[model samples]
Target: MAARTITNRKARHEYHVDETYEAGIALTGTEIKSIRAGKANLQDSYARVENGELILYNMHISPYEQGNRFNHEPKRPRKLLMHKREIMRLLGQTREKGFSLIPLKLYFKNSWVKVELALARGKKKYDKREDIAARDAKREMDRAMKNRHRE
Candidate 1:
């Protein structure tokens, strides 16, 4: 494993993920180089099934600093490779009400660039508030436990 991670922080904050899939990404040489340099962003990116194929949009791989005219586009749509059945299943899930495809994270596994795509539904306003409150409470409880252990 190359041990690189490109995370979509906002995705977790804004949506409730129901399922996840790992899919390979097709990339140019320069794009791979940029990713190896940790110059990729999945923050505003998303994946969609288009014409029976999965395509990732708005995923930014910064131009290779050393490549002059051969650098890949910073925000081009990249094709995601997966089994036909898996793509069809995702298409069906996304076609259902309140379901979407979100790029959760990008990483390299055994030299292959892979993306973790989430089958998600948008979180309502009150749901987001409750999630925040739960997270805060958990943090406070952990802190209290740590203090008690130290004393």
Candidate 2:
């Protein structure tokens, strides 16, 4: 796997992810430079397909410190690069009820910046609670097993 430069960890807890796809991002020079410096955040960011193209919204890539007047906007809607067929498939999926297009992660892929877009369904409040409980149970089990093995 290539290096995951940034991620939206909250997305996993908030949605039931169905499928994920990778697409290149259209970033300005300063935007890319800042991202390389680990100054990007995916909180509250999402993606959508529009007019046969995929667009990312609310992604915050901080301006390069030395960019001066050439820095890109901190929060801009950037275009995503993906195949037409993929975009069409996403369009079909998104047309269904309660389905959404969301960006799961941003990463460096062979020297290019790529975003991992997920097809997800929203989770209910009860579902979130259940997931938290299950995770805690699993962590306790792992810790108990480790203690036994150490004896």
Best by lDDT: 1
Candidate 1 lDDT (Cα, 0 to 1): 0.93
Cα deviation of 45 in candidate 1 (Å)?
Answer: 0.8
Off by over 4 Å in 2: 1-4
Model 1, residue pairs in steric clash: none
TM-score of each: 0.96, 0.95
What's the CA error at residue 113 for candidate 2, in Å? 0.4
- Tell me the whole-model lDDT of each prediction, alpha carbons only: 0.93, 0.91
| lDDT score of residue 45 within candidate 2 | 90
lDDT of 1 by residue, 1-151 (tens): 3557989999988999999999999999999888988999998888899999999999988999999888888999999999999999999999999998999989989889999999999999999999999999999999999999999
